[model samples]
Target: MGVSGCGKSTVGEELAKQLGVPFAEGDKLHPASNVKKMAAGTPLNDDDRWPWLDLVGADLRKGYEADGIVISCSALKKIYRERLRESCGGPLAFVYLEGSVDLLTERMGARTGHFMPLSLLQNQLATMEVPTGEPGVVTVNIDASPEEIVANALKGLASL
Candidate 1:
C-alpha cells in the first residue's frame, strides 16, 4: 500500500480479479471520525489509525479463510503493518505502490469525490515508512500504465 492517488484501489481491484479473489476497499472500513478528520484536511495520528488497521486486518483474515482477498490500505508505518499482520494472524502480502511526489500530487489533484484532500498528500508522504526490505512486500513503481503496474505486481507476488 502507498499514499493516496498511488492507485492502490485500482491496482488491488485488478489484481484480485486476475487472481479470482475477493476485493475489499479498505477506505470503506474507516471509522466515521477518521473519515471526517481526513475530509477536514487533518492528518491522522497513530491513535486514529490503530482501530482502523484492526478492521482492515479482520477483513483480511476473513477473506483469507475464504481463499484469498485483496485490499487497498494506506499502511504507512512499520508498526502499522505489524499490527495488521498480528490482527490477521495469517500470511499477508503488501503491494507497495511507490511513485514520485510530483506524480502522486498530480494524480491526487486530478481525482475528485475522494475524502482525502490533495493537501494531505504531503503529510502522507512524510508519514510513510516505505516498505523497502520488508518481508512479504512487493514494491511496484507507479510511473507505468495501470496494466503494466498490475502485471509487475502479479509477477512480484508470484515470486513471493
Candidate 2:
C-alpha cells in the first residue's frame, strides 16, 4: 500500500502465489468514471476513492475463511485504511511497497497500458500517510528485486 508505481500489484501477485491464496488487483475495482479521470491524467480525490476502497475491502473480507489472500491497493491515507478495516469487519495485514519519488517515476514511466500516469505520482505521495503504528502493517522498502521484496514481506508477515 504505497504510491502509484510502488510495485504493489507485482509484489501482490507473487506473494499470493507464494502463499497459495487468491490475488485481487484493486485498481480493477475502480469505477468507470474514476478510470476515465485517471486515464485523462487527473489525480483522484478522496470522494472518488472511498467507494472503490470499500469494494476492495469487501473482496478481501469475502475470503476470510480461506487460508489467506493478497491484494494490491494504494491505501494512501490513514482514514482510507481505517475505512477498509471497517468494511472488512476483521483484521488485515498490509504490505507497503515504499520507494522514492525518482524510483516511482521511473517505474511509472517504464510501465504501459495502465490508467495511472507518472503525473499522479507526486499527488499520491503527498496523500500517503505512511501507516506508522498501524496494526498488522509491514513496510518493505522497494530497493531490491521483487523476489527479495516478497521474501521480506513473507518473513515480516510471519512476525505479525
Candidate 3:
C-alpha cells in the first residue's frame, strides 16, 4: 500500500491473478461520506478512516478464508496497518508501491473518474507513515513498468 497514483489497484489485481486469488479494490469499500469528503478535496481524518479500514480488513478476512485475496488500500499509517491486521485476524501482506512525487503526480494527473483528486496527493504523502521495517510488507519501487513492479513484488513476497 502507498499514496494515490502509486498503482496499488493495478499491481494488486495482477498479483492476485498470478496467485489465483480474489482481488478487491479497497476504495470501493469506502463509505459514501468518505468518498464525498475526498471528492471535495478534503483529506480524511483518522475518525473517517477507521470504519473504512475495518470494512477493508473484513473483506480481506473473507477472501483469506477462501483462497487468499489481494486488496489495494492507502494504509498510510502504522496504526492504520495495525487496525487492518487486527480486523483481518490472519496473515496480511502489504506491497508498498514506492514512487517519486513527480511520478505520482504525473500518474494522478493522467487518470480520470477517480474520486481522489490530484490535489490530495500531497496530503496523502504527508500523512503517510512508510511501512519500512514493518513485518509482512514488501516495498516495491514504482519507477519501473507494471510488469517489472509486479515481478519484483512477487520476488519480495516470496522471501517474506
Question: Relative to the unseen true structure, what is the C-alpha lDDT of residue 69 in candidate 1, on a scale of 0 to 100?
Answer: 93
lDDT of 3 at 68: 94
Q: List ranges where model 1 is wrong by over 4 Å.
A: none
lDDT of 1 at 152: 100
Question: Model 1, range 1-160, lDDT digits (tens) per residue?
Answer: 9999999999999999999998999999999999999999999999999889999999988988889999999999999999888877689999999999999999999999999999999999999999999899999999999999999999999999
For all predicted structures, in order, the TM-scores are: 0.98, 0.96, 0.98
Instruction: Give a tens-digit lDDT track for model 2, residues 30-82.
Output: 99999999988898998999889989988888866565678899999999988
Any residue pairs clashing in model 2, and if so which?
Answer: none
- Superposed on all Cα atoms, model 1 deviates from the true structure by an RMSD in Å of 0.6
List candidate 2 stretches off by more than 4 Å.
none
RMSD of 2: 0.9
Q: Give every collision pair in model 3.
A: none
Candidate 1 displacement at residue 144 in angstroms: 0.7
lDDT scores of the candidates, listed in order: 0.95, 0.89, 0.95
Compute the lDDT for candidate 3: 0.95
The TM-score, computed over Cα atoms with residue i paired to residue i, of candidate 1 is 0.98
